[model samples]
Target chain A: MKFRMYLMLPLLLAGLTAQGLEPLSRARLLADRSAVTPGGQETLGLQLVMAPGWHTYADPPGDSGMAPRINFKQPSDLRDASWRFPPPHAFRDAAGVTYGYENVALLLIDARVPPDAPVGGNWTVRADVEWLICRELCRPMFATVELELPVRDREVLFPNWTPLLRRGGWPAARE
Target chain B: MHKAKMWLGIVAVMLLGFGARAEKQAPGFELPDVQGKTYKLADNLGKIVVLEWTNYDCPFVKKFYTAGAMQELQREAVARGVVWLSICSSAPGKQGHFERDEWLRRMQSAKVAVPVLLDPDGKVGRAYGAKTTPHMFVIDAEGRLVYQGGIDDQPSARAQSLEGARNYVREALQALWDGQPVPLAEAKPYGCSVKY
Candidate 1:
């Protein structure tokens, strides 16, 4: 039990850091449900955390900033139904104003699952994303995220994101 | 006569190639440094000069200064009889803008010997098309703009990014000083957007 405790301490600390404090940014893909029913829509999201003084560009991140983008990598049958983002704040620069997120931002995507997907089977959805984070200098960050879901009964992780999922449902245009 | 004709054609083609590579006359500017000295670009005519865009708070700039990469390059440039001028184009109330006394103190503390010229209105930065903090430009003795781009190939903000990357600014200056055409005349700069 003592050995197990020692092992779990680092894991707990790491989890906390990943959740709240990261060196630059920490990103993870999440799903609204643990299972996908045939002919149903699935909502996917990226949980992104930014460290102090760092910010990522928003959609339409003005003339000088690069907007963050995500691409589906696996489960070829999945098609993007919609991409959603929260409103971004305008940060004034010397010559122009840029739109971006400060502390954290949730990027959501709604995907349509093929109606013929077999029940009782497990499927993994993979995503690749590119984002620019800047405070003093800028760094381009690429993250590969995956979320596994079952077609039948399984443990659901939706409860954790229920509050956030209830926020704005469509991509924001202004802030 | 045929041999001479071929040589003439070759020279003409070479000149055309040079013309298409974004060369232009360097713009003139008179800006006050932290010490209140006005530096007129025209005053430095007949000597090779390097223009550097800088923001002290920028991580990309730190990647060079913290490692002494920029200082070493500045020393080398001076030794080669080149005048290096560092320009800060951040407008008033922007992230990198600083008051005169504080700016002087910071430069002195960092041991950066070059003049940190203030471009509060961004007129000079716009004239030179400086996009990012640390954008670099090299002007030849004849006042022709010969090179413009990033300091190096790797654009990462981390200090380790310096490890195998080619320093474009250094390479360009060396080539120009050697009286040879710069191998790569222009490369897209990568860093935080200039506050201007």
Candidate 2:
């Protein structure tokens, strides 16, 4: 019994890395800041990484393919939220032309924290994301991602995600 | 004098192109069903016809089938004297391409009442420019291609999305029955690309 438990542990831990039901693509949430300031803006993102030779579509997926339908449940403390997707590449095949992202795609969302929100409490944001990944065959996959951050007077930036959030010439968060 | 003649030629060509676009005709085709019965587009000329590109293995296609939405639509359309034809364009060894016997079984299990046409060579699909499974086309009684695009406004593969989805095909069919022009003609089709 002890030997069997040790063998299963690695497999169970591996499952945590695969955030989606389908193994071909993984979806997770990331934020550019550890905390958000009252009346300030912060960027949160749904990061999708696909297996080699597999891809997911962008908005207005060109000739065929459905765009990812991601709905974010904004916390009451947030005033407004909007999303951004990186520029997509055109994938040409025998069927026709499609527009999508290969390898990795980061769909960023900008959330505004209301000025009157109580500080010191955590604000949790949840998103329901759906996408179709395709290689030779296609799979419709969905995942629920979440991020929580403390409401602080001063925003603490996470340098690791700041560069990525700024990539592709997306506009900076408005004050 | 030569320049004037060239200008006349260009104007004539432009007018002809516009005329063709206004009354684009659905391409004629002859395809076999799972039972090896051939169906011809010309044979259904005086009747309204619907062409539905389909692949059962596709999740987008299953979105409708699993919810019984597609079957209900087909039944209602057929009962109202509309001809609904579902075509499969997957090539051999590709997804959704099955031998005749298996194909027949799948249709039976799915309770598909419409004719399931086979286009293994994708010739007919290409002729109609069918890019996706569930790509739809509607032809009027005069064989004019009246509508071409997605079946509904909701493109998600989730079965739950069928609720409150504005079914474009159903609406188009209703308009034709009421002697009204289709409200929308073309939409960005959403589905898995037809396996060719």
Candidate 3:
């Protein structure tokens, strides 16, 4: 057990900082369910934890900056229904106003699993994400994140992440 | 005399309103190049002028520079007798704000052939409403501000976007050369906010 725990340490750390550019931001995928049922709706989250003083842009980044882009690459049986981001904070620059998320941003997407998907198998969803994070200067960073869950006959919510998903359902837009 | 004065006042007000609605005349200013040579906008009134808001450190501007896209455009426009002026509006002590020596080095390394005008005070930039590093403006030979916006449609900072991307500045110049109205006179300029 001790040897196994030592071997798993790096893996756990890797999960925590998965696809992160040093001194910028960490990105990882989170699933609301431990297992997904075929023909059921599921929620997936792309979590971004930015370093202090850095931010990623929202859609329509106002006078300048590019918005974050995500390309799904996994789970052929799953189709994205909708994607939403919580309201972002407005950053006023010398030139104009920019809308972005600072510190931490969780982007949620609703996906539907096809009824014909095979049960007892695993479903993995991968996303290729790109963002331009800026403070004084901007850097274009991209990462690939994956989340895997077993395909079960019944829905099985993952306790830890499900509450977060529920509580953070799209907040009111900022005026 | 009273009626004539009243009519003149009404005409003046109408003219002011029309001027406000019409395309603004490009503001005239004199700025020094990296070599300390002065360039006055009024002196170039009879020639087409292109104003390029640039900041080398910004990734969006860097994208065009690294891909040689921006240089090619400048050369093409200059070869066609259009005066191309690269303006840096970054405030002092900010990114892309460089001394004359540094500016010379950067231009040499980047093979920039056009004159780079320094607007460290940002007066010219603000007058032109330049909000982004790569914001572009084209003035016709008659000194009217004809176009102002992004250099192109691809807003990403990635150099790969240069491939097959439509060059708006080129299109505007082509329209003017062909005596046709510019297809896209204005677009949402995208890039890092000007340091000013």
Candidate 4:
């Protein structure tokens, strides 16, 4: 029995990874700072990294694909959560054309806290995400990601991927 | 005298049957079906016809087919005396391009009762502004473009989403056949890009 268990362990783990766990894509929550001051705005992001040859769609794919969306439950917790997807590459096929990212994509959200909230409070921000990935086939995946942030009077720099914002801005004209 | 009167009555009935009804003018196209039989839009005048853009490889298409959503709708539409035509605009050497034999086999397995019309050149698809696979269009008995848009309210690719999703095609057809105004004329389609 012990020998059989050991043999199947690797296979079981592989199956989990293949099912929504990703050899294809990983979704992570990021913030500009570990903590934020009351009423101050902090840049938050839902980051996506996909494998080569696979792509998740962009907002207004110019054709039929649905845009990647992120939403917060509370009304004002992530206030002014203006999301702007980086301009996507125009994917052309025999069908027509669509816009999306290959290998990597990031959805930007600006999070703001109400100044009147209690200080030293640790708040868990929950986000619901829905996205479609396609490459010869398509799969719709969704998950709710929670981010814990403590209210403090300090600021920190955004994550390393922020520079990708320069890649090309969204609502951009496509060729 | 009674026999002559009967003959005149039969002639009047025959003339009434040949009377032409007003047509709303859907774009005319003659395409070959899966069995290489020709189907012309003009030939179906005065009858409600449905044009559905489809591609087997498309996941959005799979959503409806795999879950039996689309096939069920097709059956229901046909049973109501509605003419359903499934068109494949996939270009040669592109995705969703299946030979006649393969297409016939797939449709049979899928239990699709409608004719699978081949539109390899995409002329018909482009003419009707077909943007995506699974894009649906319904023409009324008079040939007016009644509804042209998504298949349903829930655009998610998940099959389970269809449980609560409103079937737009069904709604449009129901209203049309009942001689009532179509509630919604068009809704944004959701799916993979239609392979032109």
Best by lDDT: 2
Per TM-score, the best of the predicted structures is: 2
> Which lDDT tens digits does candidate 1 get at residues A30-79?
77776777656777888776778988877766534456766678875454
In candidate 1, chain A reaches a TM of 0.74
Tens digits of lDDT, candidate 2, A1-175: 9999999998887875564344888788888888888877877788887888999998879778889887766664332445677878999877878888888888877777777768898867887889999998888888887888898888888767755654433336332
Judged by whole-model lDDT over C-alpha atoms, candidate 3 comes out at: 0.83
Each candidate's interface RMSD, rounded to one decimal?
4.3, 0.7, 1.1, 2.2
Give the TM-score (vs. native) of candidate 4: 0.76
Global lDDT of each candidate: 0.77, 0.84, 0.83, 0.77
Q: Which portions of model 4 miss their true places by more than 4 Å?
A: A1-22, A37-40, A71-82, A114-121, A135-139, A153-161, A164-175, B1-24
* lDDT of candidate 4 over B1-196, digit per residue (tens): 9999999999879743431212334677899987899998888788889989999888778989999989889999899888999999988887788988899889888888889899999888877778788888888877777888889977677667789888888999999888988898777778877777
For model 3, what fraction of the real interface contacts is kept?
0.87
How is the predicted docking of candidate 2 categorized under the CAPRI scheme?
medium
Top-down DockQ ranking: 2, 3, 4, 1
Give one digit per residue, the lDDT tens place, for model 1 in B1-196: 9999999999879744542134788888999998899999999999999999999987778878998889889989999899999999998888689998889788877888899999989989878877777889988888888888777876566676688889988888878878789888887676678887
Measured against the true structure, the TM-scores of the candidates, in listed sequence, are 0.60, 0.85, 0.82, 0.76
Q: Compute DockQ for each candidate against the true complex.
A: 0.15, 0.67, 0.57, 0.34
**Pairs with backbone N, CA or C atoms under 3 Å apart (clashes), candidate 4:** A95-B195, A95-B196
- Model 3 / residue B37 / CA error / Å: 1.0
